[model samples]
Target: MSATRTGGRNGERPVDPEPLPHPVVDNHCHLDIAPYAAPDEPVPVAQALARSAAVGVPRIVQIGCDLPGARWARETANEFDAIVAGVALHPNEAPRLDAAGRLDEALAEIADLATDPRVRAVGETGLDTFRTGPEGREAQERSFRRHIELAQDLDKTLVIHDRDAHADVLRLIDETGAPNRWVMHCFSGDAEFAAACLERGAYLSFAGTVTFKNAQPLRDALLAAPADRILVETDAPYLTPEPHRGRPNASYLVPLTVRAMAAVRGADLAELCRAIDANTETAFGGTWGA
Candidate 1:
């Protein structure tokens, strides 16, 4: 069974201004930024969604990191038929969740999220040595483990968030024995690191960083990524791709990064669209082949 409203090659309907290059899947985005953001926000959710729709961002995983944020993610995604939810404790925010020590509480929160059919993946979780200190490392590790367990228990795909802790993240994934079809969200490591993760059955997702001229290494690594294993993300309102780089990011901008990914993979726009769209659908437990 497939979602008739938003799936496959015919997932999109025509919008304004420009023709959509192709339908895209925004692998990750934090919609929970509303609390910290201004109430009279310039970029309203509808506006952001319209922009995304305009550019053929047919599906997006609105990730929720904190307790309130996760709840908001659900509400926000519910507002749009095409958007889905990916609920998890971001590494930096993992300390706020007591999943490792008070697992029942954490499980309850997860169950609350999972009860909603649209919450597709279980993360934005994993190690982040670049930001986490020694005191926070233990909690981060515990949170990562709990997220893995949560994915296993819920039978949802895991969206890993690894940053400057590639080795540690790989160790944890190996030690825990991850379920099939996990995506390394916003993968930041080099080609070798990507290869290592690929060997472990984890898909490497590239973000707008690959579009940076200085990101030649990311460019090279992307070439090594097999078509079946490559995915694209915005990590928005951050990592906006070129021309729009450094500006507020959104799912609508996914096509820019998708174009860059296609160039790296030596695939044309159509081929890249089909491949990435299929991989994203598979990652989120949706049927891709029509």
Candidate 2:
């Protein structure tokens, strides 16, 4: 539905995981890219939501990191009661648009879209040093600062996408002052970085990546994070969890991540699910209808 040849486009669709004991929201997902990654046919937003609902994932934050995706996110949120929107240009995209001298124009449009009721956050933003090199860092930082300011200006939650740039992300947040509400989407840092983010009142949203055998550090971060400040997401159709690694991810697979989080935190499964539901609402402002 958005973005061409996304990271998700390579895997086969996986079977659904067991249903969660309590309702939870996939704090981040890319409904627009689900079909491109796994199956031949695109799963309509309605079908995707229904599939998730049948399990206990009742809501989702549809993140749009480009202009067209932003439009899709807002429109989809408006059409579906279970969805909300977050808009921004991804860090890697910032330099491309900047080189074309259209960065400001794009940011301006994002600013305009940020005012929509269904648009609950101003992100999928922040530094992504992994994909964006040195020459692109300036534009990424510039775009990040702009998004932080936009979130503050609009009193909306900020969703950050920190990839191999944890220090810079913390620096930028400190320099600009984080919004009242913000989340480290698909948090990939260790306990130290997790502590840093927690110190700044950032919610740590764990994705399926946490279930990887090599993700002990991330699990440690989860263990260290305060219960109220934790969230769960699929980041679909990527980072498919254990038992389904290399397969297409979706909201329905959230239960796998939630279960892993529960085990890591040594908390009750249903309790963790309930906390994730509440944490997601608090992180994104509130439930879509409320």
Candidate 3:
């Protein structure tokens, strides 16, 4: 879904940060959600790719939050050599579809779209108590379980989105059993919570939020996470990194987050980049694009 930014720096696009010493994949991004682009204009996919590639982020996993988005993700992945697709009804979306009595129909379409070769993951799924309330919890959990099974059955990576529902997310994973490969996208957990997820064999994908001033806990998680289990993402048009916090984000800005992550973990920049690059391949069930 496209996120609307209001006031001040939100309207400004930040200048690109220095390129990374080594390339890495943006494991999660909504290239289709172009809040900074002109109305009715689809996100400038080619331009975005070029900008990101120029900054050492040469590949991206385009995530689809709904049926329309799922189809677009598959089509975009097919058109671009530097992109792969992750298709699913987002956590908030599930409750809405269920309320409309169309959840099953939408999920069936996601399953079909997921079968496409360019679609490498079944995700952006899980729980979101922050946006969804008790009235929707059952539908949300049900959808999360189905997506988990779909990923396992299709042998695709599972990319989970947990927002203010950490325990329940872990509970569902424990109940359903995780897929061979799974990621905690935009991981918003403390070091202790991070250990819990890591114990489940999850790859914790950190985003620009890790660079926020109030995100010391997130940084602690990054520091505690093992090198091979860490991944990076932009979640673009959303979690733009520091010095550019309120601006519209794109994959080109990944270096800022990766640099902050390296500093947090007190690790060598290029080595951390190399590990994240390799971890993404393992987490996502192999490499795609350039």
TM-score of 2: 0.96
lDDT of 1 by residue, 74-141 (tens): 78777777788888777887654543465347646866686677778887788887787777888888
Candidate order, TM-score descending: 2, 3, 1
Go through the candidates in order and give each one's C-alpha lDDT: 0.75, 0.90, 0.90
Model 1 pairs in collision: none
Q: What are the RMSD figures for all models against the true structure?
A: 7.0, 1.5, 2.4
lDDT of 3 by residue, 71-173 (tens): 8899989999899999999999999999999999999999999999899999899999999999999999999999999999999999999999999999999
TM-score of each: 0.86, 0.96, 0.95
Q: Estimate the lDDT of model 3.
A: 0.90
Tens-place lDDT digits, model 2, residues 263-284 = 8889999988888888888889
> Lowest lDDT 10-mer window, candidate 1?
1-10
Higher lDDT: candidate 1 or 2?
A: 2
